[model samples]
Target: MNLTLHVNSEQETLDLAALLATLLEPKDVLLLEGNLGAGKTTFTKGIAKGLGIETVIKSPTYTLIREYTKGKLPLYHMDVYRLEDVGGDDLGFDEYIYGNGVSVIEWATFIQDELPDSYLTIKLEPTGEFFEGRNITFEPTGEHYEQLVEKFQKQASEEGLI
Candidate 1:
C-alpha cells in the first residue's frame, strides 16, 4: 500500500524524510517528483543526516550528480532536470543506482527509461493552507519499497509524527 504523509513545516518534512532514511539500504532508489522549491533538497539533507553524513547536502542541479560517501551508506544524489533536453543516455547513472548506496533522483521523469524496474517514488506538493504545509506521498513500485513504506508508516505512527 502507498503511504501519504502530511507536514506543516520545513522541519517536519526533513524529519519525515529522515525517518524514512533509517529504513533505507544499499541499492535503494528514491525518485523525487515535485515542482521547483518543493523541498526536494531539504528532504535529501534530512536523509543525509539520518545516514550519518556530515557534509552539507546541496542540490546537484548544476553538477548533475553528487556522491556522499561519509555516511553509513553512500548517497548518490542526482538531479536530472538539466537532462530534460539532452537526455540521460551516456550518464552511466546505472552504476550509482545499482551501486552499494542509496540513490535519490530529482526530476526523475527526465530519465524514466534509465530507471530500474523497481523503486520508490516520492511526490511532494504544497497544501495551499499554509506556506510550509506539504502533502507527501510514497509510491512503491515493488515488494521492497512496499515493505519500506509499511515500516515507515508504522514507525511514524508510533512516534506520532504522521
Candidate 2:
C-alpha cells in the first residue's frame, strides 16, 4: 500500500515520525529515500525520539551507520552514501536487516539488491518553503509492513498526528 504526508514544518515531520514509530517492531527494515535537505535524517531523529532513545539523532553521512537503543528496541540507523563496494557476503546485511532490532537505512538505494524481501520505504521531497516543507510517501512491501502502516495510520488518526 502507499501513503502520503505533507509536512508544513520540521515539527510536523517529527510528529509524523512519532506516529510511525508506534508501528515499528524489532527486526523491521525501514528504507528512507530523499535528496539532500529532504529531511530524511530529521525525520529519523523524531523516530528515535518516539522510540525512546535518549541520545540526539544526527545523520550518519560519514559514519555510515549509527545504532540507537534505550528505546522500545534497538535501532540500527545506516547510511550507505559512500559505499562503492557490493559483496553479498561481506556486507553482512542480514546481521542487522534480519537481526533482532529495527533498522533504518538512508541512501538504501545504493544497496537495493541487498535489501530484504520485506521492508518499508519512504521517499521524501521538498514541496514548498524549500527546507521548511516535505512530502513523504511510504510503500509497504509485505503483510508485516502493511500492518505496520495500518497501525500507524490508525494511531495517527487517533492521536491527530496525521
Candidate 3:
C-alpha cells in the first residue's frame, strides 16, 4: 500500500514520524529517500524520540551505521550514500536488518541489492512553498508494512496530523 502526507513545518514532520514510530516493531525496515536537505535525519530524530532514545541522533553518513540500543527497540540508522562507490557486500547489514530492532536506511538505493525482500520506503520532498514544508510518501512492500501504514494513517488522521 501507499500513503502520502503533507506537512507544513518541521515540527509536523517530526510529529508524523514519531506517530509512525509508535507503530513500528522489531525487524521493521524503513528506507528514506530524499535530496540532500530533505529532513531525513530530522525525521529519524523523531523516530528515536518515540522509541525512547535519549541521546542525540546524528547522520551516519561517514560512519555508515549508528546503532542506538537504549530505545524501546534498537535503532540502526544507516547512510549508504558512500556505498555507491565502494559497494556494500561486506557490511554484514543482515545482522541489523533482521535484528531485534528497527532499521532506517538513508540513501538506500546505493545498497539496493543488499536489501531484504520487504520494507517500507519513505520518500520526502520539499513542497517548495516553505523551507520546512515537505510531502512524505510511504510505500510498503509487504503485508506487515502495509498494516503499519494503515495504522499510521488512521492514527495520524485521528490526531489531526494528516
Candidate 4:
C-alpha cells in the first residue's frame, strides 16, 4: 500500500521522518528521492534524532556515506549522487544495507539494481505552496515495510503530524 502526506514545513517533515524512524529496525532501508534541495538530509537528520542519536548529522554528498553508531540502531546515511558520475559498484554497499543498522540512501535510484529485495522508498516533491512545502509519498515494498508504514501512519495521525 502507498501513503501520501503533505509536509507543511521543515519541522513537520522532520516530525514525520522521526515518527517513521521509531518504527524502523535493524537492516531497515530507506530510499530517499528528491531534487537538490528537497530536504532528504533534513529527513535523515530527523531519523537520526528518532534513533536517539546526539551527534550532528551532515550530508554525505561529497563523502558518499556517513555512519552514526551512537543511536539505538546505527544509521548509515548515504548519498549516491557521485556514483552516477563515477559509474562503478565496488563500494560493497551491501555491508551497510544488510548491516545491524538503518540505512538511508539519498538518490537511491543511482544504485537501484544494487538494492536488496525489500526497502521503503520515500519520494519528496515540491508543492510550490510554501517555501518548505512538499508532497511526500511513502511506498513500502515488502511485508516488513508495510507494517512499518502502517505504524507510522497511525502514530503520525494520532500526533497530528500527517
Encode model 4's per-residue lDDT on 57-126: one tens digit a residue.
Answer: 9999999999999989999999999898664388889999989999999988788878999999999887
Clashing pairs in 3: none
Q: What is the TM-score of each candidate against the true structure?
A: 0.97, 0.93, 0.97, 0.95
Candidate 4 overall lDDT versus native: 0.90
Each candidate's root-mean-square deviation in Å? 1.0, 1.5, 1.0, 1.3
What is the clash tally of candidate 1? 0
Question: Which regions of candidate 3 fall more than 4 Å away from where they truly are?
Answer: none
Q: Assess candidate 2 and give its lDDT.
A: 0.84
In the range 36-138, model 3's lDDT, one tens digit per residue, is 9899999999999889898999999999999999989999999999999877898899999989999999999888888999999999999875555898999
- Which residue pairs clash within candidate 2? none
- Which 10 consecutive residues of model 4 have the lowest summed lDDT? 84-93
- Model 4: runs farther than 4 Å from truth? 86-88
